[model samples]
Target: MVVLATKVYVSGDAYERSRDALRSLVDNEIGDLDVEYTIGVREDNFAIVTIEGDDEVVARNVLREAYGEVTPNFEDGETYLGTLESWGEDGIVLDAGRDIEIPADNLGLGQGTPIQIVERFGLVQHMPLRFVYREGDGNAGASELADEERDRLYDWTRGTGRVNVNSATRGEVRATVNRAGHANDIVTVERLGLLEQSIVCKEGTDPPGLLAAIGEYLPAEIRCVIP
Candidate 1:
C-alpha cells in the first residue's frame, strides 16, 4: 500500500472551520481510505493540516480536485505559504524567521519568522522509534544515513537491510552495480553515499557536486561510524 501527504490551511479563530474543511475534503476525496489528520500552528490566523492516506496516486488526485470546492485559497495562491524558489533543496531552510519576532519574556509565540514547510513526498517512511546498533572495538563501526535521507533512499533500500551511512570511513563503500551470478559491478558504497549526498556530479549534472544539486541538504546531526 502507498501513502500520501496533503496540506490544508485553517482560517482565523476558526479551528472548527479548519476541521470542517479538512473533514469535508477527506470525506469527499478519500472518503473510503483510512485517514489520519494532524494539525499544527502555521503563521497567524491559520493552522496546517496533514492528511495521510493509503493509496498515494488516488489520494493526491482526489485532494487536488477537491480543493476546488473546499479551499480554493490554496489554488488561488491566497493561502500558499510561499513559492518553490523560497524553499531550498533540503526542504524549508528555516533560518531565523524574517517577518515576526517573539519577545523572549512574553511567554507566547511572539513575532516569529516566516514559516517554510518542507513537505517531502515519500512511500516507505519509518521513524527510528528505537536504535539497537552499537560500536565494535575502538574502530567506529557502520555508518548511517541522516534523517533527511530516509525518505529519498527509502525505495532503494527497502529489502537491502538497514540504512548505512559511511561518512566516517576512509575506504570506499561498495555496492553491486551490475550482476553476474550474485557478483556484479563492485561500486564503492562511498560512491552511493556521495551520490545520495550529491557530492559528485554525474553526467549531465550542471553543477559538479551531487551535494550541491541536493540544495542545502545538510545532516541534521552528524553520526560517527559504528565500530
Candidate 2:
C-alpha cells in the first residue's frame, strides 16, 4: 500500500493564545486514531504540520471529529519524521503500565528531553503500543512477532517490510525514505542535502531516464532494478 504525505493547515482565532494547546488537542486526538504527526511552527495563529502513514481515511475522519471542520489535504509522496515522544517532569510518560526500572540518563530521559519512537506493533489502537527511548534511559523495547501472526489482524493494520519506489509529482520518492537514505546511508549522491535534491517520480514519468540516473548517481548498495 502506498502511504501518502499530507500537510494540514489548521487555522483558528484560538491559535494565538493556545498554539500548543491546539497542537496538543490535534496531536492527541489524531494520534489516538493512529495518524502520525510531525509538529511544526506555532505562530500567527496557524500551525504547519506534516503527517504520513497508512490510515488516511481514518485520519481524515478523526480530524473532522476533533477540530469540528478540519480540512485535510493529500499529496502524492514524502521523507517524514515519525512522531516524537518526550519525557520531562510534567511531560508525557511511557504508559508501560508497570515501572521498568532503569537509569534515567541511559534512556536520554533525564527530565525534559523528548525521544523518538522507532518501532510499533499490534493493531493500531487508541492506546499506542510503542517502542520508546528516553533521552538518558538505556533500555530499548523490541519483540519478535511471528511472521504469520504479523500478517494477521492481531498486529493492528501496520505491516512491515514494504516499500514504494514510485515518486510523487514533486519529483521524489517518499520523503521519509528519501531523507533517511541520505542521512543514515549514502544512497543518492547528493550535493547539498537529501531534502534539497530535485528528484521526483510521478505517474507516467520517464522510468528509463530515472533508472539510468539512479544507476549513475546513487551508490551500488542503494541501486535497484526497477521492474
Candidate 3:
C-alpha cells in the first residue's frame, strides 16, 4: 500500500466523481502492467493504492514517479510532494501524511512574507507542491519548496497570468468558465492535480477579472496570478 502525495478533499457527489477520475488516472498510468490495484482514501484525504501481481514493483515505481508518495518516514534531503495547508506571517504549512512547515526564507520564490508569496504565486489550498525535506534534530522534519516547483510557479508568471483553484476538477472549472460566459477568455485549463486546476488566460484576458467573473460559480478557494 502506498499513500499518494496528492489529495481528494472534495465531498459528496464531487467526491465520487473525483474517485472515479482517480481510478481512470491510475488505470491509464499502470494498466498495461500485470498488476491489480485498489484505490482508497484516508481520513486525512490522502489517497492510498494497494497493488499486487507480477508487475506490482514496476507499477508502484510508476505511480510514485507520477504522483510522489507520502510515507511515515521522509528521507533527509529527499524531495517529496505535499498539499498546501495554510500560510501565515511566519511561513506555510503543508500536509504530506504529516504537517510540514516550510519557513518564509526557505520558500525561495522571492523576497516576501509567506502570505504575500502565496498570493503572488496563486497557490490555492490543497494544491500539491514539491519540496525538499530537512529532518530536524529529534524533531519532525522541515522542508523547503523544491527548485523545480519554484521554477514551475515562476513560469506561471511569465505567461499571460492564470487563476488557480482548488476543490474542483479541471472539467468543473472549465464548465464554470463557460457558464460565466468567459470561455474565450481562457486559453486552456491546466490540471494541477486531481482537484486543482489552473485557468490560463488569453493574451488580452485579465486574470483577476476572469477570476472575479468565475469565482461565484466555484465554491472553492480561487487565487489569481497576475502577470
| Top candidate by TM-score | 3
What are the per-residue Cα lDDT tens digits for candidate 2 across 136-173? 32333322122343233222223221111211211233
Report the C-alpha lDDT of model 3 over 80-188, residue by residue, as the tens digit. Answer: 8999999999889999888888988778899989989999999999899998899783224457899999999999989999999999887888899999999888899
lDDT of 1 by residue, 1-227 (tens): 11112222223433454355445545656768676655443342122446665654566556544331112122211211111113232222111112111112211112332121112111111111111122332213321222343334333333222223222111211211111111121122322211111122122322212222222332211111111
Off by over 4 Å in 1: 1-13, 39-41, 44-47, 68-227
What would the TM-score be for candidate 3 when compared with the true structure? Answer: 0.94
TM-score of each: 0.22, 0.21, 0.94
Query: What is each predicted model's overall lDDT from 0 to 1?
Result: 0.27, 0.30, 0.90
Q: In model 2, what lDDT does residue 18 have?
A: 34
> Candidate 2 — what's its lDDT?
0.30
Which prediction has the highest lDDT against the true structure? 3
Tell me the alpha-carbon RMSD of every candidate: 18.7, 16.1, 2.1
